[model samples]
Target: MKRIRFVLITLSMLLLAGCGLQNTPEFQPTLQDQISLYCLDHEGNLEMREESGRLQGYCVFTDGSECAEADFFNGVCKAGEIFGEASKRGEIGVLSADEAVEVEVNSGSVDADSGSDEIVLE
Candidate 1:
């Protein structure tokens, strides 16, 4: 029964994913297409100034329900566990929102300079 529910929800999220996946902040060797790594306890924040000029806001991850909203100068990234089925069912409390965020620890940059041939998004 549990497996069936997981499969159904997985299918739903897949169908809803259109193309906004390149902005995930999980800090992996290689980024996943539509899946961002969700952290359980370790939380973080970042003030990113993208060269593309399309991300400026806050990225927060706390207890559950992480979100990322970038603007023109700096952007934010976060990840956390979610309780209910619908992702939009909760509020952004601890990870509410911030503009002056900064990246203290990042795993994504470790992947940026590595050889493209040895890179794989697992």
Candidate 2:
């Protein structure tokens, strides 16, 4: 009886050991993960949530400013530089002078006081 119990215990231990030997693949970080990591390293706050069966990430700076990273819109902060509005395919692109000028011109056209507080009835 003692020998039979020893054999059973040894087999159980071997089975448990074999369970840990799974051929699981290593985790690979996605683009959103990479962006979130970059933001985290740049003194920014990270927020992650699931929406519509998809994961989304957002990064907010210390000065109450948030950056956007999405399709056709890429915003990342690296080495004290802000990169904005471009395609993000695992690469960061610098904004050019002409694009900056265009953005400035477009932004200048919007005036906070342009809208009248009182509506005029005809």
Candidate that would win on TM-score? 2
Clashes (backbone N, CA, C under 3 Å), per candidate, total: 11, 0
Compared with the true structure, model 1 gives a TM-score of 0.17
Q: What is the lDDT of residue 12 in candidate 1?
A: 85
| Candidate 1 deviant stretches above 4 angstroms | 1-46, 62-66, 70-122
Indicate the worst ten consecutive residues by lDDT in candidate 1: 32-41
Tell how far residue 114 is off in model 2, in angstroms: 24
lDDT computed for candidate 2: 0.56
Question: Model 2, which residues run further than 4 Å from truth?
Answer: 1-20, 48-56, 69-122
Listing every candidate in turn, what is its Cα RMSD in Å to the true structure after a full C-alpha superposition? 23.2, 10.2
Q: Name the candidate that leads on lDDT.
A: 2
Q: What is the TM-score of each candidate against the true structure?
A: 0.17, 0.37
